[model samples]
Target: MSEKKKSLKITDAEWEVMRVAWTTKATTSKEVTAALNEKTEWKSTTVKTLLSRLVDKGMLGTKRTGNKFIYFPLVEERSSIEILSQELLTKVCSKKVGKVLESIINDSLLSVDDITRLETLLKEKQKTAVKEVPCNCIPGQCQCHLVS
Candidate 1:
């Protein structure tokens, strides 16, 4: 993650393919399509197209394994996730970030370890927590004094 990351805007379909490659370390198109089929109605060709697009976008790299190409994630999964999360958070008013995180936590199914991790993170963040988060919203998009 210390290495500079590319600003790749991955589509939802491409994310599905990337997850498979990241989980398996490497995969051929057949493996990706097979894994995706369990969760999506996408056909094999659709999965292949997404894989090709990811490769072109440099999110995925491939090596020829005899006659077939095995695809692997070029970027670390944690780095990619952080990039995407930050991108999403930037679209909303800064004041609403806590509410957004709360909503996400409520909706997600967390394991005991995950809950413990969040508690630890929250405790650390509490050290510098502000009394009020200032609204950093675009004008006309939100009701805030920061908005002209």
Candidate 2:
């Protein structure tokens, strides 16, 4: 299977429509509208507008089912999350990565098993990078404590 990538910017309304598409793949406009109407206060016309925008942005694909158009997500949620993560990292100072990670680790309600898995991953990464890696942050900006 070919992995086609597209840079589609998601808006709030578009995100709502995408949630429905992700749950029910190859869904019709009527199905999406019904789902949104049942779940949110958005009108059918608003959902239709979002659907058309998504199709125009190439984030969604359409196929004819008789006289109706069925919409399928061209981009998966995981891929979009990965892209957003990278974008966030790029925007943040390199020195802050360590401090940010530390905060996240401390603040998150991770289970014991999750902590164990994170430790295992850290050990693997430590083994791979024997030497200290350079900061991804701007000079003098990174607060990353990369060294053990």
| Best candidate according to lDDT | 1
Q: What lDDT score belongs to each candidate, Candidate 1 first?
A: 0.86, 0.77
Supply candidate 1's per-residue lDDT for 19. 89
lDDT of 2 by residue, 38-128 (tens): 6687777788899999999888999888888889999998887777665555556654556667887899999999999999999997877
lDDT of 1 by residue, 5-94 (tens): 446588888898898998999899999888888799788889889988999999999889899999999999999988888877777788
What's the count of clashing pairs in each model shown? 0, 6
Tell me model 1's lDDT, rounded to 2 decimals.
0.86
Q: Which residue ranges in model 2 land beyond 4 Å of their true spot?
A: 1-8, 105-113, 128-148
